[model samples]
Target: MRKNTFNIFSFDTTIRNPQRNIDFLQIIDKIDGKVLNEKSLLIYWYEAIGKGIYRPQNINAEIRNKLLKGESLSESEIKRIMQDNPQKVQNGFEGRAITHFKALHSQLLLIYDSQSKVVRISKLGRELLNHPYDVQNIYTKILLGIHFGSPIRKENNRARVFLNTIFVIDLLKREWGKLEKESKGILRHECVFVLGIKDCDYTKCVSEILTYREMYGLKENREYIENYCVSNDLKHLKYDTIKTYVDEVFRKFAMSGLIIARHNYYDFSSFESKKIEAILQHYKDYTFMEFSDIYEYIDFAYNITLPWIENNEVRKQIATQKAKELHISLQDLDFNDLTLLENKLNQTFYQQALKSKIEVSQIDTLLNELRILASGAQEKSSLDNIPEPLRLEYLLALILGKKYGSKNLESNLIYNENGEPLSYAPAGKADLLYENFSFEATMIKNRNQQLNSETTSVARHFYESKKQNTLEQRAMLIAPYIHWDVALFFKFCAKEFDSKLAPISISSFITLIEKSATFSEFSTNFDRLFVDKLLRDKTDAYVDSVNFVR
Candidate 1:
């Protein structure tokens, strides 16, 4: 029987750029074992090809029978049969047979002539036929060639860079796993749909490839395929046909386990979670450390693990059960206490032994070194300079101190017996401290420098002083000009400080001090008055009235 041939020119327009054709093969390779059994197709084609050169009239019948019988024909027997049946050769074309032949031919499994006279299996087809079960490595090589190989030409002198197939596959698998279910469905459907119709015509092939390319964020490849179609004058494929093809491919992939398909959705399920997590780790901004720095350790222990835990009733309950473990009171557990705990946990035995041996003989030298360190260290309050709008804080502090017989305060750096500096301890409560009243000063100048020294000083004092034995009776923020934005910021900080720090304008503070007869009365009505003033129509106008530069 004469081999059937279609007009190669009709489909030449479909794959105008050879690169797009290669890209299609790569898509196939990605789904080889999972979506389609390339080996089954290879075996069927191999046996059919060995049974003599097939024409459209005899190709399908010959292959179907052999497949059903589970039979294989040797090369010599096929040649002998062909020689005996010379009269059976007839010239004609069959559409279904031609479609099947063209599909395999496009994939480079077979070669055919336009005259419908000759059809032969390719070398790759023969290799796949012979080693069908163990052809993964060979299949991978073929796929990589399709993905990276370019036709050689004299005019093109540019270099071509190719990503490693294994690397590309690994990256794609991980990225595929990360995609949401809907995205995975879209990608799977589009890829399969395009490849199914790729051999139909040049325009249909380009449309499918372009559709899939757009979905994958491959703009450069999409543009190349689109330009190729336009330059080649290929007729566009109908939208309905493309949609039908996509649905069909989606169904096939669903059955193959490349993706988990539901009623209307799909998700990638082929990758290992451990491998995917490993890949994801490379993209994270922070890493988990087993032994953190001293500051971070303190933050984790205090803020994260045991915040508000010190000097609490909970310690008494702990003392009843595990009193031996409770070496010190919770109130006395400062940085030095925590450092010693960490050292006991993390320091190796040899390191502790060496340290002890050196410390016994060099105690005086250590004391002198610590004294030098303490003399070199000095703690500066954030409110020291008092920048513009913040300079208003100094005025507020001065006014409060003068009117209430309070004092302007600073933080004092505490030192150990050896004279090494410990934590910075505040000298008194906030910027101004009266008998039981604490007043903080804040100034807002620029948006970036919203919270200056005075603001932080007040916040710190309010947080710490409220925890004292006498307990702070009241705390207030004194700002000359509080922009609406700055006020909102204070509102946020208020939550962090347990709402102890009431932000009030300097003008409001002065008015309250002048009107209230006693400190108790001032504290009782301060919040209500501050809220009334903050919410008044004149608040924005008040911000505008202030001489910010001065």
Candidate 2:
């Protein structure tokens, strides 16, 4: 007789006479209202068995050890055990494990006695022992439960108990599948990547991996698949195919409510509009007009503004409420009446801004300073003969010195043999250094390089400077433009540098300085704007960077 194979659900146990007296419905009823789905039912059943709440006669010591030690037995050990115990092996267990294992099998009978404290298998758990492939549906259902099931439900909690079991089973199935050897290798690499194994094959591409990890939740581990073609040197997996796979996964995640779908124009339902209004209410103390300006300027009209407008019924109610507050009749409410509510809201926001020390006079001063800088930028062509990088460095030095009263602003900075200039006092420390602040500038005209070496070099300078200088001192990277590749490299540097360095496009830096000078507000708003560019929406950044590059 052929030796039986072992699987995730398999167990070794002695058989006993069938227990016809057991009440299956009553046992299920005891779990009713608790097991919400098929996944939950499976979990509850597995847990009860694992805890010895259910014990079959002559349970295999190996299976008992696995449960106690939280380890899985090897296939060889399972086969050896089966070969050593011929008397305990049923006729069905004499063959290799099947590809798919269903829930119900003839050799195993679920036994639960009302008077007993434990539930056990009547003919032992022999039927529980089968090939993992035979149970693909069961494992997939369990995975769905673990990924999508609500934790408040006992069923979900139950499903979690079998998470490891399903993981192992799934791995086994993937290994045993009919996929080509190269495909199998790719899957193995992916598994290692997801586990965050330090020595994984994809570790060579750490920068890309880190960027993908940040953009999408690290739990997805789809980065491995995304980089598969490039990493594995496989030409058949075309870019289009990879893109389709990624898009499909993203769509699935969006459907499951794990993430919002990326869209140009969000079609807001009535409920969604109300939800947005509630969200806006949370930021009611912010500068309403400025906030709206920033939102619209970034072209987030569809993504952010429309989502916050109240539904028709809610708008009508708001109009009526405003009319009542103004001591007017409901019939008197018109489009202008709607403006009353908006004005009232803006008034509250303005009051809050005033409390926060934002004064009209300060804003006017900052606006004037911005105009001066813009004029200077347009008129100054004296440094045009210098290399782009050196010119940018000198320009930033001048701007920072003018703004912050730094004495380090000089046009004729020293240059090294490589044509890279020592723009500031300390060589290679930064291109521009002011009081408690360091700036590094990179202005590359070419985009032919696969990797943005200039961006990486400047980022490295920023990182080293921050380490040598006080961690609290502001370190900024000034770049003419940040294309997609450079943006990804920046993200990588952010992770490696502990997020201490900020990337500032020339345009954004100018805008931020203008805002800060005009509003008399803290320059930390630049950090907020940088974050918005990175994570919220990239429309403004993309447009600005494209024009700058051109």
Candidate 3:
């Protein structure tokens, strides 16, 4: 007897036979029968929702139609028809079943994917007329709660029922396909209520959920295929290949309402509700994995899903709704956790660089880092001269690298109009000019002079030639350092380059030599400079000490 049956409905029962000759009256008698009514609808709902047994479809349709038609029942028509059970309230059995699964009944009637087509009773429901109670019904409340994607209501309520449905279905299906004992092979999809690609035939209805980018509408089932690709790590698969795969499974089985709402992809939102659902479903198995582990997984999957959902207006609305409930605002949040001021500064600096505008935020971040380095000096009491100069040089080096987009020390240049070379300069020559004189290289070169020569000169010379040919004259005539002597070196370099029509900055130095790439390149050179100066001063101090002893 190769008879097929639903998971909870079986035909091998005494009450419902193929002949339909059984005494319907006697059957109702044993159950303390009562006339069917809205309450009975609850009982049938319990059987279908709680036990996975399909309720009689015709009966529901009859009730709805009657209610709509406003047909009133006679006193006799409303009473139990069972001759022996006129006294019974449709039998205690009927009442108990309804009461026991009240939670399941409430949820499905309320929010069962209002979009799905109306369903009717299957032949299997008829077969279960007198079947024994099934235990799978126990998990219904839990699965329903999960499926509904709602918060858990107080004990054994509608929300609980929805979650229970999701839980059981997920466990029974084991990730909607082949079950893996290790559980690691299961594809983790980050979504809210997404349909599966396996349910749609892309070849025929490809534009089902076409998005903004895939505007061609070639074969995008909009929601399902994208989620499927994300869950299954099939991102590398070609478009047609994925479309073909989606067509095979989900073509007819559309009862599953797996669509979920999320913020603009993963990176744009803080916490996804679907992540919480996943944890609830798989928490026991993931206990040992750190919280960060799950967080990372959710984040990675979410970012990948961004391109598909970012432009979705409805998805954004839903994401916003969920975020509000969780007390998070997606608009002003970022992954870096930067303060408003800090963020503004960082962004301003980047914009300034892009648009060729000089800025000082680079100056601030560098100064902050320097303050940190200075505060951490190993010998605070000793207060060595090398430390402060080294910090200053290093700080200037970073500023130059950030401002000029080059970090190499050798790229910094200096020259005169007469083709004479000058001496070494700081890496952040541009920043120095902007800060010291509140103007760029051109303005400063036009008005400022070295050693009170208050008027600009047109001496044409390169740093190399000036230092080699007229080093003494150029050094004496070079621009003055406003705050530090090290900064003056860069100013002199810029002024000299402009005089010779070279106009090269430290950035040019980097382009010239790729290896000595950033102001940090000058770290070694500065260190040498620092040590030489320190030794010279120390020698003078030693001689003074010797003279005092004599």
- What's each prediction's clash count? 5, 11, 64
Q: On a 0 to 1 TM-score scale, where does candidate 1 land against the true structure?
A: 0.23
lDDT per residue (tens digit) for residues 1-550 in model 2 = 1122111111111211111112222233344334234443444434333322333334477765453322334555444444544443234331211100111121222332223323333222222122211121222222232211121111111112122222322343344343332111122222222222111122233343344434652244444554653354333344444444333332222221112222321111121233324333533332211122211322221122221244555565544553454456666546555656544432333223222222212434433433333232233343333434445664554455445443333222433211222222224445555555556665432243213555655666666666677645545665544456555565556566656445656666777666665222424664565633554445456435423533
State candidate 2's TM-score. Answer: 0.27
lDDT of 1 by residue, 313-394 (tens): 4333323222223233445433434435422322222122222233333323333332222221123322222222222333
In model 3, which regions exceed 4 Å deviation? Answer: 1-71, 79-141, 144-329, 332-550
Worst lDDT window (10 residues) for model 3? Answer: 1-10
Evaluate all candidate structures by whole-model CA lDDT and list the values in order.
Answer: 0.36, 0.36, 0.27
By TM-score rank, best first, the candidates go 2, 1, 3
Better of 2 and 3 by lDDT: 2
Off by over 4 Å in 1: 1-90, 93-99, 113-118, 135-141, 147-235, 244-269, 272-550
Which pairs clash (backbone N, Cα, C closer than 3 Å) in model 1?
Answer: 2-55, 3-55, 13-202, 14-202, 382-453
Which ten contiguous residues of candidate 1 have the minimum total lDDT?
152-161
